[model samples]
Target: MMAPRNIAPIGYSGGSAPRSGPSGTLGADNRLTTYANTTRRRVDTILELFFADKARRADSDRLPPDIVGALHAHIFAGGSRTRATLCALGWQSNGGQERLPGAVLRAAASLELHHAGVVAYNDLIENQEPRRGIVPLRRMMEFRYVSESLGKQSAGLLGLLTLAWSDELFHGARLTARQRCAAIPVLAEMRADVIYGQLLALTGMDCDLGDVDLALRIVRYKTVGYRYEHPLQLGASLAGANPDIRRTLSAYARPLGEASQLCADLRSVFGNPLTREQPRPEDLQRSRTTVLFNIAAAVADADQRAELLTLTANPDLDATGAQRCREIIETTGAAAETVRMVAQRRALALQALEATPIPMPAAEMLRVLARRVTANIPSSCCLGRGTS
Candidate 1:
């Protein structure tokens, strides 16, 4: 194996390197903020134009106006825009120039739409009620149905529509043939990976205790591949980065993505004030099988295991039961193990970053993003008003 490179530590306080693009000599946070704000403005513009176009043909369009409203609401709802940010970072890694290319921005914005569609569908499948502190798109539409079957069908159609819009935006971007060829297949792969991962997770809903491999497999495909790997690759591809650069980015992305998912799992149980979406205990209530639960099951005593199984088995876990489940997970040492795993994975990601040949600023941005994704938020923050 090639030894890792000796890149400067991210956010290093030593003499700063010259800045790239319009970011100037700004620190990691400032650079990220600049990118995020710019991308957000562009995304808002895209959505507004889309809605405006629809309004012009409201009568001719087959979709209901309310559905459009719901989609708009979903877009405006709280999100960290992590994938999009990573996309921009990937472009920067390849020496992308000033003013933030329009093609890159459009492609990045498309990621958010794709994510929205996936989440809507996932919420329906998991029977999750609230998303971003409001009723999910499917549930909102389900209210119109006289029967569960009809409601599900309608919601499924809406989800499909959301995905179609995502594609429309993705292909609508102006790109060279080379960029398009590089990016389109990756986008297709991302969608397929997420769908497969979801299917795998659903299949493992009744997974046996201590099924750590299955849990990680699900994470690799569902969270890591779709959320981290694909977006980074997509951005790099759009920048016309070579295969070696893309491979290096993936190396950094893999461990970071796994760590990110682990942190999310931890936050779901321990609570994070920084996260403005999803209720605490939401994971427990949904009985979403996660690595945490699998580890807890593996370490718990027989009686404790039985207790956990029973709690998770409950279709509607009450607050009291939720509390007990937390206690069981904590007392069993699974929580501690998860924390350890998070740290380990973060270290691995950073190590990969140090070895990457990407530009220093891009590498630093990835480092900053890694910390942002994995760090625990202060308790004083609200659960519905922070980065996603």
Candidate 2:
């Protein structure tokens, strides 16, 4: 467990909205707006280009008509394109040139595609409907009467293919075969980690009290690896970053990724306003593991814990029952504890940045993005130290 020294959060005081990007149709809102402002023109442009490319690729007769249609719909639906956008931004931050290679754009697109595919899988496993504010792909493609197995399997394989596409983008005669080979292992590991974590979550393994550390470990392996380190490393590697810089960036990325996931988990527990999606307390109804359930399980006494467990374990828990469970988590201070955990991870992320020799602008941009990510979570703001 490596720890870094104190680094205060960079506060954003001005209550001003970000300037609109060149594409005026898309406006900024809250955290996303800042991200849009920071990477606006370039990120937005490349993302549109990527979706266009994926749509084209899916349109080709390479796959069945239904599968391709499903894939296309999944890609174009209202995703934030955060992963791809972040990769592009990371490349720029690392002194990579403004005009990214086609391969780089594809690599970034690979992340978004992979994410979309998994979201579909998540919906199937959790038996939930809704992604990026729209209906889940499972529901979109499923036979209403029959179970959504075929649709889920299709999306799962598509997700697998999208993840594999990341490696294909990096492989070529242009780069040394040895370099390409070296990159494959790291990328594979990252993809595998996410799959395993997702599977654990799907199985409700996150409910076991002793498994919280294991759950965190699962997230660290699955999420922190790809969303932060691997993408940065890939960019750094493409630009020929030194081992020291790679390691330093990894250090900085880990906590940031963890913190980001924590915020997402918080959103999963406490509805997202921008997306206008409420947290599904009955996510476990579809086998989704949640931070709220984990904390409640850990701190609540036996009878109380059993009641919480009943709310989670019971498939019968409807919207009203789910809301009650949500109430219990909040009443028991589990929500407060989760807030503390997110703050701790966020602080750790900032400290890791301090330990490294990153430039001010790049660092500030990321800091702003991090705060915006967590701002939606009221618990995140009240970190128990009165930072709110």
The model with the greatest lDDT is 1
| lDDT (10s digit) by residue, model 1, range 1-388 | 1112222222221222335434433477566556665665666576668666765666697767776776776666655566777788788778886345887788888898889888878878788767445677666676766576777777788778878989888888898898899998999899998998888888888667688888888899888987899988998898888888888888888888888887777667666544344344557855456887788777778999899888878877777878888788777777777777777888888888766588877787777767666666323222212111
lDDT for each residue of candidate 2 in 32-70, tens digit (9 for 90 to 100): 444443433443454455445655676473754455555
Which 10 consecutive residues of model 1 have the lowest summed lDDT?
Answer: 379-388
Please give the distance, in angstroms, between residue 216's alpha carbon in candidate 1 and its true position after superposition: 0.9
RMSD of 2: 8.0
What's model 1's overall lDDT?
A: 0.73
Indicate which candidate wins on TM-score: 1
TM-score of 1: 0.86
Give Cα-based local distance difference scores for all models.
0.73, 0.58
TM-score of 2: 0.77
Each model's TM-score?
A: 0.86, 0.77
Clashing pairs in 1: 80-388, 276-383, 276-384, 276-385
